[model samples]
Target: MSTPESCIVAGQLAELGHTSLYDLLEQACREYADKPAFSCGADSVSFTALRSHADCFARYLRHEAGLQPGDRLAIQLPNLLQYVVAIFGALKAGLVIVNTNPQYTAPETRHQFADSGARAVVVLDKLVPLVRSIQPQTQIERLIVTSLDDWRQPQEQGDAADETRFMAALAIGRTLPEIETGRGLDDLAVLQYTGGTTGVSKGAMLTHRNLLSNVLQAVSIIKPGEVEYGNEVRVSPLPLYHIFAFTANCLASVFTGFNSVLITNPRDLDGMIADMQRHSITLFTGINSLFVSLMAHPQFDSIDFSRLKWVNSGGAPLNLSVAQRWFERTGSVVREGFGMTETSPVVVASTGNTPYKEGFIGQAVIDTEMKIVDDQGQELPAGEPGELLIRGPQVMQGYWQRPEATAETFTEDGWLKTGDIGVIDEDGFLKLVDRKKDMILVSGFNVYPNDVEDAVMRHRGIRECVAVGVPDERKGEAIKLFVSLHDQNLTEADIIAHCREQLTGYKVPSYIEIRDDLPKSTVGKLLRRVLRDEARAQVQP
Candidate 1:
């Protein structure tokens, strides 16, 4: 058992070998083979069963599907047992896994599939139509679809029937071409897509080493003496496609041999509470909104919180009022963290038992260097707000197919410019003041103003448009649009209706303002700060 300070100074936090994740699972299976590894409702997968299933699927992908090393396989399934099995199987077969959100539309899915040059896709049956519509436009040559009931028994069967449709798909793939095995520690494992501040989505190439490094760094932060390995229970409700959950919840749990209770629909708070009670969950990882919702739920008071040991929050800033109320009720502190899609998504986190500062995002992780720089890229002294830059083993290799964009993201000295405005205090804790770019964070999802403006400008009646974020009580911040209409007769409803068709639900503007002209800079660039100030003035009275 080692202290957090000792672990940080020891510099033992680095990338694990490619085989380390699997080897840890083997050890867990050997020790606790009959113990549950994952559970959902009445369905459960034991450590032994999960490892055996992963091995079977890995062999199937290598021998039957003809998938070779470096081949890309896009996964568009929700949180389920198959999601873990597919990801581990693909990695074991030496294939790069590209994660796609199940909520993506046909165009969005096509763009990622085509860009990654993926040869095959594994998706849910409900989303098969979205994939089928995009298949003609993508390079995907094979499609494997699984139903929601593939692993669950039918109502008439009374939960006793074994649904083997999922297993059958793996068997079919195994009976089909033999592919070469190319497993290596330094091989590429994941291509995580991120929407840059410029509103362009690029794939950040993450190798096995990059992911392994993040997992080791996260493990080091948790005081080993405070928590026991193999006996700890974790709840993972965040979407697995996002890198934040992929590393902290999924990979970290696997590395420590903990039982992870997966929640497919986290919005079902009542069901989540039931699962928490059943498992006596010790560690819970989620975003700010999730914690807020859980605390506000009427049934929240019924759940016993004494068994909980750790609570981790990320993706967005935590609300101070919510944190205080949560601690009052649960007797546990919410450990806030910060990171992005480029750094394997875990750069810093607060200690589990420490008293939390309202706005600080904690100190840098082990084996990582962080500095704040001005617009000219010169490092700034402490207590000054500047762009945060980071360099570490967990940093991504580069963006896929966009060498120019990749080069611009990193500095000449190889540090990754995070585009976040923050200041470091004397204690090394960083406080985020604002974002360098005009990216709006609604709840926890990143919403680019340019993406909304682009969609709004497509309307025939709209002449000019700009989007900004305004403070909101529930969502942290809500999207607000300022527009000049080409046709004076057009109303705000008309503009919102047009945007709804082109943008996602979260990206649509919640408030609309009509203006004859917008403020601009000497270079004719839109001054979003002026618009934000105008919005603030209207609410001050």
Candidate 2:
């Protein structure tokens, strides 16, 4: 395998000189103007065109919307050209970009908007109703809406009425005033939310320096000339809101000036496979669930995997069965890595030629310091499973507006306590054993039990509720709820119905277990571990 020195280029790429992501993309545009920057189905945008469009959008945000630097602009749309335009435009205009899941319900969307204090929102048409429903309760003053077919259509075939409305919203931007631009490398770039063990979703304050450092750190891992500017092709099926894909796939592609094939709807397996067959993707990054699902697809066997030079798996543990199957089918190993949203998401990744380990999460990236520590915050010996503490430039400054939580997450010496139980082998391979946090990962997305329990407790007929993760064949783990009802006549169906009203699809419990009482400690704290154990035992033969 090539060492880190072998991957180091003599000089930085032209894009590397920019302080902000926007400047970086603009630099690429000047250097590789004719190269394709983005593609979706048959529609494509060149680096030069993308830069011009981004400039127009940025000008629209500055002149029309009255937005300024450091202001938060919430983005709620699937992966597409607009997603890129909006993201780069906001960054270029000196705005803090707050990513929102397009699939979020009204309540979920409201929480993010309110929490982030976003003043503007760019939403897809299908999600406009959800945004409009919660607009009154949010701080959003400007709303811009776009449809899936907005950029892909011929001008005559497009919805002129809807386009006029969107342009009017952009025109309203002129009446609003702009703030002075003073955004710095240390200023917040993205407010990426992460579900903590306490079940509270806090925004990780990733600064421009934090993200830039991660991008550089990742670039150091790739061999020079292996993937060049504008020539590399990346397949990004993961949601752009996810920090893993946001940095590795989206921003990385921008840095390298690659043609990023944006998959707007990854759930359409047949359609996604068809796209893969059409494009000769060079770098493919995904989670275990995604790989497993793709392997299960009937058309998956027919796709050409020989062209794929790099495959990375993260977000969740990669299963041995899936890895073996993938390697046998494609002769390419899925390089497993590990990171958290708080870390600007890239910590460790296995190299292109490294041997595949069944459960190891590779070694720390260049210049990253990682150590395993015991519960008391003392460093542990190698091979001992404990909490992982990381110190790196990519680590976020802290949780936004959360001083106490932030203080608790970091050590006195400045190491970030990752809240993940893992062990480092003598050779430096980190193997994750379990999560110290009670957070359940459903299909690689965090599902906090406390959040669900809180929603369930809000039900009038519910006395108490406990949420636990149960093993699932599809999703890595599914939430199983145990409830104690105030009324004896209250049924499981009724309880579930109430939960569905307040929670997102993944947060809603899949299985409802009725219990007279739950196991609690002497201090009255719920014994969630006991419940999880019981749930696992029940599923076993």
Candidate 3:
């Protein structure tokens, strides 16, 4: 039993006994005050500037918004300088953060707000309409609307009726007393939501210790490859709302004094390359789809990859072809990791300059223990595929407000039951086998078939729909939809357009097939497995 003190005394690692994330951020603000903390387009926020701005925002949250400690603040915005500010500010104000995807539809936003019982929301101006339409259905009261122009200093503010200005909050925060965040390590810091097998999003209650430990664990494993005294410049194209990016790129970068570049849309390979070349980024965090997109780009080889020290991929399985091409194009290996929201999103990761291997997701990270278990809760032998169970300081407290689901998600001794089936090799490497749930993966984003089906079925013309992932050369898996329509006149394009409005782009089905009827069980329940097998059969040679 290594005490937190002993761990710190044993070696040089970031101390994990802080009261909260704000405690760590306050320290970083003092140590790397002048360094670039986060950047988006032409706007860059220095560590010192970030602290001051967050202070102002926190004061406004506590005083103006009337939000008290432990109150949940939902942040719905893309990767921008404002996203970083609001995250730190919410922590400084002793509020729990519920990261909402900016691309979420109105119904999704409503569900998250209603489930989390969020009182305040900071949203993008373009997304305000969605929030506005759903506010009546949720507890959301305080509305803070910002724009892309708000990344820096906006010359003219947009017309937002009954909504507070983001810059205005910062200005008011400057005058109010500094927020005294009285949070303990055991206090809830974030409510990271992930869709269950049922397609209903459930929030994972993550305490400060959970996240702080994960950050320290990550920092220790990656320390060997990091530049001396935090000279690491990281390029982050993934959404910060995702737990993987939140920990790896945002929190880790701030703690270690890395210059973090925020890429809003990586689909634009030209823009992404331009930013990468501009920063001479040393560390890259992306998914298989992103890596493949960059490698296939015309200007990808033209960019300098000599400074690229490491490339970390997660969210989806890394294909050998993409990894090989990435290493050949850039002089860096693609190290893959595996995790879930309940584990603070990191369970296994390749560390240091270790030779990257296909199929394997590296050894368990620092202070993290994992095992393979059979259905009877018995441990499996090495090289045997079973449900992967994880126990670590980084594991979440459990699903928020869902005791039964939480109980079912963990073993009697408290190991988190990662729904992923995996086998651990004799050398302690973990290789995934399959997903126990019928969840679909599209471009590294989890797309629950039920969620997509539910959205499509909302259309009056659609009687029944089935969503499944099919093999994609660019994305590891792309969604294909099978539909039985009440109105035969409805075209695939019509249903797709309807779905585009209801779901995010990634979750939208790329291929649609008209079906007379969908396979169903004797009890009249939709047999998703039957459809999945049929789809796989179609793709087979």
Candidate 4:
């Protein structure tokens, strides 16, 4: 009935030794002291370096600032070494980390600070002014800033008018005695916020046990034999703010003692490939659009792929063509996983070297239980689409400080309502249908936007696109597509015909509009809400 790894996680927590985030870090530091833990630009921190830096920052928080356990530490940086130092340091200091999106506006940043009640903020130096202007609105006390251009450069002193540099915090902390804090297993470790149905960011209170469960679940999914410990070279382009990359790439790689080369600007296709080639990357993780850009780059073909053992896709759905091209070009099959911020981000992933599945995300990850349920909350049969509910150790404790919201999200039986529509095959591969909120009702038929978008993307002329529901007099709701093209000559009729070959009549976009580009989130996920709003506006009187 259940997958093989499901039994492993459900009954094996005691077998895994770590008690908290600090425990995991200490174990890695002891085992791989001199091994490279993280790299940004040209600089790297060994496991011992990571431990020392984190300990130093923790010392400053405890000895210098007098902060106590359960204090929130807000981190607002992209994929940089400072992010690692601040996050690990915060965790080691027994502080709950609030992973703020670096692309957030001043208002958004201020909201998170106020909501999380963060005492200290570790941010990119460039964004300090933005935070400074809004500092009076929150409870911020300490401001640790660092330049992405040079995180490793030592500075004994920082800007007197503002606050200390990220490196200066480490220097000051090192001079103090060891930080005397180690939060236990049930203590909160992270506050990864996600926009729920209310359209407001609600923090997910992920505990130390939740993160440890996910780290081990993900590591089990990725066999040790497939990736060499302390020797694997991984090119991680995803931002650490997102739970998917935070747990899978940053946390997992560090726990395994693998060297991760963090890319600040994954949009630079040439540079991402350059980093990959330089590291002779054994593992690469990215979204569908990022992989597409890399494949389209002129220099992508020149990169060596002899050592590439894995290519992972998450954060969004993996397009079939992108997966096929990656495998054909690099001889490394893409493993697509699925999860959300509340689930510690990785609950399912395709096993090693598995060939591409058209719409399948993967089978259930270790200790994770997923099933489909209809409107009445009754469980659905395998292969029947319905809202997916999940239960596992990796699932979050609850939404931070929102008891009512958290209660509504979980079933009385304890399953987390995923708010996503999907189908699980008899063999356990989970195939995504679409977000429940984004489903279009054409007459009596249910049309999933992802289905239409996936079919259209296979046309070769379509470079990127999003599908949304529009009002229709007869059908109640009709499909409208916004797409950007790879070929200037491609026409609406060409797209319509391509859809006819792969989808049913109601599933095809009734209106196919081409554009220079579609609006997307900072993580490159197509903003379906944007397109949906635009579609509704066109129908307004």
Q: Largest TM-score belongs to which candidate? A: 3
Once model 3 is optimally superposed onto the true structure by TM-score, how far is the C-alpha of residue 117 displaced, in angstroms? 0.9
Pairs of colliding residues, candidate 1: none
- TM-score for candidate 3: 0.94
Rate residue 121 of model 4 by lDDT.
88
Across 1-541, the per-residue lDDT of candidate 4 in tens digits comes to: 0112345653555765666777667878887888889987778889888888888988988877667889998999889887888878888788899998776666568878998999888888788888988899999987888886656565545665447877777878989997656787678999998765433568999988788878888888766478777888888998888898899888888888889999998767777777877776888888766776787788988999998888887876666766788889889988888887888988788867343456788888767889999999999999999999998888888888889988988988788988888999888889877667666655324466766776687788789988888766445567898999999999999888888776645567889889998898899988889888888899831
Q: What is the clash count for each candidate, in the order shown?
A: 0, 4, 0, 0
Highest lDDT: give the candidate number.
Answer: 3
TM-score of each: 0.90, 0.91, 0.94, 0.80
Candidate 4: worst-modelled 10 consecutive residues by lDDT: 1-10
lDDT of 1 at 487: 97
Give Cα-based local distance difference scores for all models. Answer: 0.77, 0.79, 0.84, 0.80
Residue-wise C-alpha lDDT for candidate 1, range 1-541, written one tens digit per residue: 0011223323443322235345556666777787887776667888788776777777766665666788998988878888888877777677898999887756568889999999888778777777878788887866666666667742221111212235665665555444334655457789998887777778999877677778877887887587887788888898888888888767777767788888888889988888877778788887777887888888888887888888887887777777778889988878888888888888887885343566787888877788899998999999999999888878888899898998888887678988889998877788888888788887677888887887788788888888988876456678889998889999989888887887767788999999998889999888989998778566521
Identify the runs in model 2 with alpha carbons over 4 angstroms from their true place. Answer: 1-15, 154-182, 224-228, 353-356, 488-493
How does model 3 fare in lDDT?
0.84
Clashing pairs in 4: none
Candidate 2 on 376-434: residue-level lDDT in tens?
88899999999998987788889989999999988877789988899998888899888
